[model samples]
Structure formats: C-alpha cells, structure tokens
Target: MKSIFDQRRERGGGTREAGPDRATVLSISSHVVRGAVGNRAVVFALESLGHQVWSVPTITLPWHPGHGAGTQIVPDDTAFEAVCRDLAGSPFALEIEAVITGYFASKAQVEASAGLIAALRRTNPDLVYCLDPVLGDEGRLYRPPEVLAAIRESLMPLANLATPNRFELEFLTGLGAHDNGDLIDAARTLGCPQVLVTSAFAMLSGSIGNLLVGERSAELAEHRLIANGPNGGGDLTAALYLARLLEGQSPEKALRLATASVFEIVARTARTGHNEMALQKEAASLSHPMAMVQMRTLAGAKKR
Candidate 1:
C-alpha cells in the first residue's frame, strides 16, 4: 500500500486530476523548475488550489546543486537584472491574479525581484503578494549577509502577507525569540500587513504543531497560533493561507484553511516517504480536503 501522497499520484482514483476551480498564480523564484524542496512544494500547492501557475524562472538549473553537489552561478547579475527589468516592462500585460516569491541567490536577484514586485503592484494594485522571506531558517542564514541586508531594506515592506518560520521571524524583527513578549511584539512590527510565523521544532513536542499569524499594526483580529501539528508542512501552509486570503476570506478564515489544508496534505504526504513533491502532479483530489476554520473578528482598531 502506498501513502496518501503516493496514492494521489496513481491513476484514476488519485488526485491526478483533482484541484481548485481556475485561479491564476505567478510563481517567481530561483531555479523554479529544479527539484529542490521549496519550489517543488510551491508548484504543487498552488495547482492544488485550482490555480494555473505562470512562472518566471530567475535562473537556469542543470539540477538542484545542493551542498557537496557543486554550485555554479552563471547568467551574470547584469544579464539577470536586465531580464527582470524587461519582464516588468513587457507589453504583454501580465495575466497574474496572485503572486508568490521565494529564495534569492544573490543581492542582484533580490533587488531585481523587489523591483519586479513593485512593478507588478503598479500594474495591478489589487494583486496579492505572498512572500516567503527565505533569508534563513532555524537561526541559520541561507544567503550572504548582503542578500539578507537587501531583503530587509528592499523587498519586505512590499509584501501583503509573509510566511516565515520562527528563526526567519527573529531576523525580521531583531528580538529575543524565546520570550513570548519579544516574539509577539516582534510579530506586531514586521513589514508586511500580515505576518505568519511557523514556530520551530523547539515549540513542538510531538504530534502537535504551533504556528502564529498576526497583523503588523493597528489590527482588528487577535494574533493566532495553531497548536495542531502536521508533517512536511510549512509550504502547504503558506499556499493555502494565501489562497484563502486572496479569495476574500478574513485572516482568521485564511489561517483556518491554511492549517486545515496543510494538515490534510501532510497527513497524506506522510504516507509517501519518497520525494516530498510527488504530490504536486496529483492536486485535484487532494487540495481542499478539509473544512474551513471559522474566525471571529475582534472588531476595533486604529490605522497604523
């Protein structure tokens, strides 16, 4: 017997043809088509949401060259920057309904990506930006100090919503993450309008998961933390959360869907110990397997 994730990939009865209605999403990331943990998970999640994704791959990949696998950077920063600028200037009018951004391998990529976001917003102010500040995780930095610096100074303030785990949360806020006072306070001060934090392993004891999502400032709803845990989770969390929010679900409802959907997917994925992304191609049957988490508004606040 195969895992739920594996089952989905099977013929007929599987999720092979299952998923959302018909939403369009633009996925902007580095080496997007490559088989890495991030983009692979993202592609499947969006498609599962029933959205058609149009990607703007920032670089070419022979394959995901991870540690010891030998990394190579070509396509000079100047060339990459030019492409992004041209993309932003395209006369073809971007058909994007929603946008998601992730990892930047260099400072040039960061600046260019941020500029693209600004350009996209200018083109369609109502568009939603779902950003994953992949600067680092678990107190470790993924990019050089300059790249992190660039993200902090350039891209963050432009996001409508952000999906960052606890460690990334610390870099974003510069506070002691261990203290609830510092952590919660930091959540209230981030650049985006909504900040979603996936607490680290330390916050999890067993089959339980604890995550936080809150408004930056002058918010109507109270901050949230879902204590129910799931396996191979965060990617699905951010995608479902963004989809719900973009579809006009309130923050609380968005969190609910995100949590529920992520849990369902993980429960399914756990059955497949193989590559985490095998679920990508079988989205239809599995995307929205759970019910919505109902949220009540706090009902009062000042505009920041």
Candidate 2:
C-alpha cells in the first residue's frame, strides 16, 4: 500500500519533498448515507477530476429528505467550531486553494463556515470561494429563516463565486426575476466576481439552462430538461465547475463541461429509474462528459 504522503501526492500531484503542486478543494455540505447529495456528490465529483477533496459535513442523514423524512444528526455548535479551528490550524490548510459551501443544517454551521473561510483566507488570500446557497427551490424554503439570514449576511460577501438557482437568487436579492435579464441584473447586484444562476430561462422549448454571469460577460449552457431529476445536480455542478477552474480552464469552457456532466448524469439516472443520482455508476461523466451542451453568449450582459 502507498504511504499517506504518497497517496496525497497522487491525488494532488504534490510530493513531500516538493510540497503541494496542485490545488486541494475544501467542500462543506451535508452527508447522506444512501444517496448522491451534499458532500458525497461533491467529493466524488472533485476526486474524479484528479483533485484532492476535504469534506466537512454540516449534518448527516440516512437519505435526502426529498425521498421522505429521515433522521438528521447534527454536530454540537461548540464541537463543530472546534473542528473548524483544527482545520484552520492544520498544516494542509495552505494546500487548499478553493472552498465550496452548501446545505448548512443550522445557523451556527453557517457562521462556523464563515469563520473557517476567514481563517483560510489569512494564509491564502486568493482562495476561491463558491457559495451554493441551499436555501430553497421552486419558490419554497428548505432551511430556516435565521440560517438564510446568516448565509446572506456572513457568506455572501466573502464568496468569489456563487451558484444559486433562480428561486434562491430571488431570495438573496429580495427581487423577483421573471427572465434571464432580471437574473443578470440580480447577479451583478450580488457583487461576487462570478455568479452562476442555474435553472435560468432557456430559449429553446423543452430545455433548461445554466447562466454564468461574470464581471464583464455572461454565457448560458443549456441541455434537454430531464423530468423528475435527482437532488444532487446543484452540488455536483458547483464542485465540477470549481474543479475545472482549478485545472485552468476558462469560464466558458468550465460552464459548458460542468453543465454537460450534470445533464449526462441526470439523464442516465432517469433512464435507470433511480431516485438518487447514479454518480457511482456514471463516474466517467464527471471528467470526460460526452454530452453536448448548447453554449450561447447573452447580448446585453453589461459591466457593472
């Protein structure tokens, strides 16, 4: 068996002698025992792309609540903060180049996550932070009001990128978005360097889109809408997009590839008639997605 150092080196392309040569991403989210959601989906997606992933779970469940209610095991606030502190002071902290957060179980977890982000930034100022506000979907809220308030107040300002679906974006800005133009405007108001608004308006019939709004540009990657898709698409998309960016792919390419991968997985899972995402079976889609995504540039995406 390979030593721990050798294993880390293989995952991150870093050696004990030469130190970290590739980026390691820290993903904070929920953990499910039987499904591909939260940290399970994100960790697998990132690792499949040859990046070392450090997972921090805000809560644990037997399965996603969507399939029906299950037991939720959440850590105590004090102990959770201590774990965050431990990671902050870890020697491997500097090896982390990106952080992605999703699915906070409580307000305290959101605060602790913000603290960890602040601590990591102290050592690596250029850390890429992606916030996937797991607040709600289809115009409904999943997390409580205080958790939403904490994420809006604490994490939004610190994010380098944000991946919020149309409903979550509306909640974040407190503005109603009727179309892609409204989403572009709201995304600019977010003040993050980049905002990827998923579930955007697709021009074509029977399709869906992921709109990437940057400081000076906007692009949309659309695919056929898969009916009754699984619950892990947002988590998988955020992790895969971050992984591609760490690999030095441009924003457009990253969006296209991530969208394609997610579309492929969802389509495959639908075909297999699985309630949870088929991440383990369709692992190849993560790195080398063969699905074709329609890419287009929005004409009126102006600089702020």
Candidate 3:
C-alpha cells in the first residue's frame, strides 16, 4: 500500500514507492486552481474511495467559474494528443480501467478526449468510459455551439456511461425540459445503456428538492431522490458513480452508493456555503453526515 505522504510527494517531487494498480481510474476535466468545481470534487471523491486516480487538468480558471471569471488555456490539440499518447505508453497505462471526462474547454480537447477513449478501449476494451457532458445548463450553452454539437454527436456516443443534468439531457436528447415528465421516457430516448440524472426536483416536495438516479429496466431498482446540493455537485456525483462501476458494482448498488456519497458531501457544503467540489473536509468527517437524522433515516431504509 502506498503511504499518504508518498502519494502526494510523487506527483512531481518524490523518489518514492509505486502503488498497486487495482484498476486505476483517470479523472480528466477542467482545472480550478483558486477555487473548486468540476474535476476537483470528483477526483477527490474517487481518491477518498481508495482508488488510484490519475488526473489531467484540461484548463485552468482564475477564480470560481460560477462568478463568471475567464479561464486560461493549456496545451493545444497537438500537445494534448502528445500527453494522451504519453499516458498510453506509461507505467500506469495498463491500470487505466476507466477514463471519466468533464468540461471540455475547447473543441480540440473534445477531439483528443474522444481519441483517448479509443486508445484506452483498444488496450482494455472493458475499460469503462464515464462522461459527464458539461455542455450547458437550463437551455444555456456554456461552450461554443460547435462544442455542444461535437459532444452530442462525436463524444457522448463513445461513453459506456454518461452523467448529465436535466438541462444537458434535454439538449442532448432533443426533449425540452419538463419537470413532471417520466424519467424513463427521457432515459430511453437518450439511448445510453444507463443514464443518471442529477437535477430532477419535481419528484420531491417543498422544503428541499431531490436528485433522481434511474436505470433502464424494471429489475433495476430506482434510487429515490436525494438531498439538495449546489451546481457542479454533479462532478462529485458522477465520480462516485464511476468509482462504483469500476469496482464491479451492480447498477442498483452503484446508484445507491453514489446517492449516499453525494448527499453526505452536500449536507456539509450546504452548511458551509462552500463549493460542491469542497469534499476534503466533509469526507474526513463522514461520521457526522452518517449520523444526521435525514441521512441516517435514508441509510436505515437502505440497510433494510
């Protein structure tokens, strides 16, 4: 087992020991240096779950993006492709059991990601590719329109699993956003084997809304709505879901674990008014969330 000190030091400055493969999961997404969002939370969650995580920061923003600050661009397409190629030939190459992607800062990144997915699949055909398509929200297009079109057509189809919010789901599926409509209808129309939606509040009543985690067939159990959370929390949610998938967990169990993990972190975020990706503190104090009345009640039902 790799010690905590060794793992942190090895990133750039350590002469240290190598850890076990145990199905390494690569976390690729936009970077947030000064603040939190996207890959920050998801990668942290995956690490917390004891998975060996390799991260690729796609782009770096100056501040919290929710505040509408601009971000800086990194290696162009050629550089990005070179990095992917390098990874494919590296020692950790064989351990990449999955590649989880989010927030493509440019069209080049999207194309490179698609290529990496192909390369990873070529080596480990069973490698799970989970894509959290960060296209846009609530009918708003976040990236360029062409990027949206590329994700809808080129990128998403290659994913074994893709976690998209309701707004993003609508844009990808051509179904307009409707709060009361059947989630199954949306899932079926979307065409992915499994679809986990993060924002679907109509299933819950007043006080706070719920998150619906659904699967295709009747045999698959439905994860009832979960506690409230802020935007970009989906990054954490998707990470948890992917970790479970990589662990060989069943669809139903994956959903349950994902729900439990997300709600636990969200409760802390809610209290602290912090970014959704801020799970470092909460994950450390997981006992508190498990002991919460609401979480405990939900967990009790699960244990039953």
Candidate 4:
C-alpha cells in the first residue's frame, strides 16, 4: 500500500488549502460507523468551526458500546506504526497546529501516537495536544490497566492540556475528587499544566459542572443536567473546547462555549429520544451556541 506521504506527493507536494481562516488539527480516536462518538464527534465539531482535521482512527466499531456489542477492529501494531511514520514524515505535517487524542485501542497504539506527537512538536514547538483520557466512567474501568498506564506515563507529559472527567481524574491522580477543592488538588497532582475536569460537582441543584484548573486560576461552567442524554458528550466537549482555544478565545470564554455547546446538544438529543448525539443536525451549535452556562469563580483555588 502507498504510504500517506506517497499519496500526498502523488496528488501534489503542496499542503491542502484550508483557507487563511481555518487552522489544521490532527485528531486521533476511535471511529464508530453508526454513532457520533470519538472521531465522529471530534471531526465534525472541529470542521463545523471551519477547521481542517487530519483524522486517524485507532479502532473501528459499528456503533458505540452503549448501544450494544459490535465487532471491534484494530489495526496491527506494525501497520499503525507505519501510518504514524508516514504522517510524521509527510511534508504537510507542519500544517497541523493542534492534536487531540482519545480512546486508544491498544498500548502499542498509544506509544505510536506519542511518537507522532513528539515528531510534530519537534518541528512545531507551539503545537497544542489535548489528551482526553477515555478510560472509563461511573466507577468502572473500561480500558485495560496497561492502556491507562500508557496514557498517564507516555502521553500525559506531552500534552499541553488534558480533558478528563471526574472519574478519570481520580484514576489518573490516585486522589479523591469528591468536591471542587478535591478536584482542583487532583488536577494539579496530575501534572498537566492545564486541566479540565468534567462531570464536576455543581453548586446549583439539578446541574453539572466543568471545572477548569490552570496554573493561577480556576473557573467552573455549570449547566442543567439532562437525564438519559445520548452518549458522546465528553468527546464533543473536548473537541469544541480545543477548537475555541485555537480561535484565540480566553480559557474562561472557551470553557463557557464548550460547556454550552455540549449541554445544548445533549438536551436536544434527549428531547428527540435519540440514542446518539445529533451533532450533524445540530452542527450550528458548535460554532454559535446559545445555551446559557453559568460560570463561577472557585474561591480559594490554590495557585502554583
């Protein structure tokens, strides 16, 4: 098979024109043929915001596991490594300003991704890598322990920011995140310069929060809890948040927009009784979300 570099050269040696307004992003995640999860949610959200995405799928599934068990296909280790190598050596690799990774299918894939990130950063030091550690949720371990370890050790150090849900934060830091204070402490311990903790405790009744923990500040974006909402909320949140930041929005502003967009999509999905996120039908929300997200300053948040 022709490598990615070879394929690109055959078409043209020039980088793909994304227009001056759009930034290029490389997104690596799972791909579900039937649901809006993993790369499906991420690629659509980024592209909806007028960004070009270089999507790489770690695993392929018929649909999300929540719907039912389906055939899972993961590329062999050598094949995956070869693809990563091709991308890293491609002339257009420098066009990528950001990378978002989630749902690695294996430990080898995690290492391959880390290697690609390292190679990209060597040429573009300003590269932003968002690590969404999709291990498990609701007090359970969905991925193998080795996969979790690879993320913590191999990928965490290369990440500019991390979006981990409350459960994932605890698993990564080995610390309890029962309250906002605990969440902040755990975020710091995780060693990421910036961290966003979703599914955080909310001050208002019947609401959930996304907490942003930075070097010197912390904020929470809270919205109404939509019960029985469709899957892929976190995937969408991580993607949009990165997109907003790439657009030069402040951390606080980015948090608000990402939180609002996800909340809007979740509420809409629930109203329609859909099993998956209606991201395609609701693509406008990714760019112009009208949902209100209550933002608050977390007092006494420690500064490092």
Candidate lDDT (C-alpha), each: 0.58, 0.87, 0.63, 0.89
As a TM-score, model 1 comes out at 0.74
lDDT of 2: 0.87
Top-lDDT structure, candidate number: 4
Off by over 4 Å in 4: 1-17, 302-304
* Poorest 10 consecutive residues by lDDT, candidate 4: 2-11
Mind giving the per-residue lDDT tens digits that candidate 4 earns over 1-304? 4422233335342233664445699999999999899999999999998889999999999999998899999999899999999999999998997899999989999999999999999998767889999999999988998999999999999987899999999999998766899889889877777799999999999999999998667899999999999999999999998887776666799899999999999999899999999998988888899999999999655443
**Cα lDDT tens digits for candidate 2, 1-304:** 3322223334654422223444688999999999999999999998888878889999999999988888989999999999999999999898777799999988998999999999999897767789999999997899899999999999999998899999999999987887888899898899887899999999999999999998778999999999988889998998888777766667899899999999999999999889999988999999889999999999655344
The per-residue C-alpha lDDT of model 1 at residue 13 equals 21
How many residue pairs clash (N, CA or C atoms closer than 3 angstroms) in each of the candidate models, in the order given?
7, 0, 0, 0
TM-score of each: 0.74, 0.92, 0.78, 0.93
TM-score of 2: 0.92
lDDT of 1 by residue, 1-304 (tens): 3322122224222111223334466676655344434556666776666666766655555454442353554467888789878867986436554678776778888798788778977886655678877776556787889988887788778777778877887887786565334555666677466677655322222433334445432221122233332223566567776666544455665565666555555545545553343455435424555533333332222232
For 76-176, candidate 3 gives per-residue lDDT tens digits of 77888789888876776776767889988778778877887887788876667788999877668788988888887777788767788777887787765
**Which residue pairs clash within candidate 2?**
none
> By lDDT, highest first, what's the ranking?
4, 2, 3, 1
Better of 1 and 4 by TM-score: 4
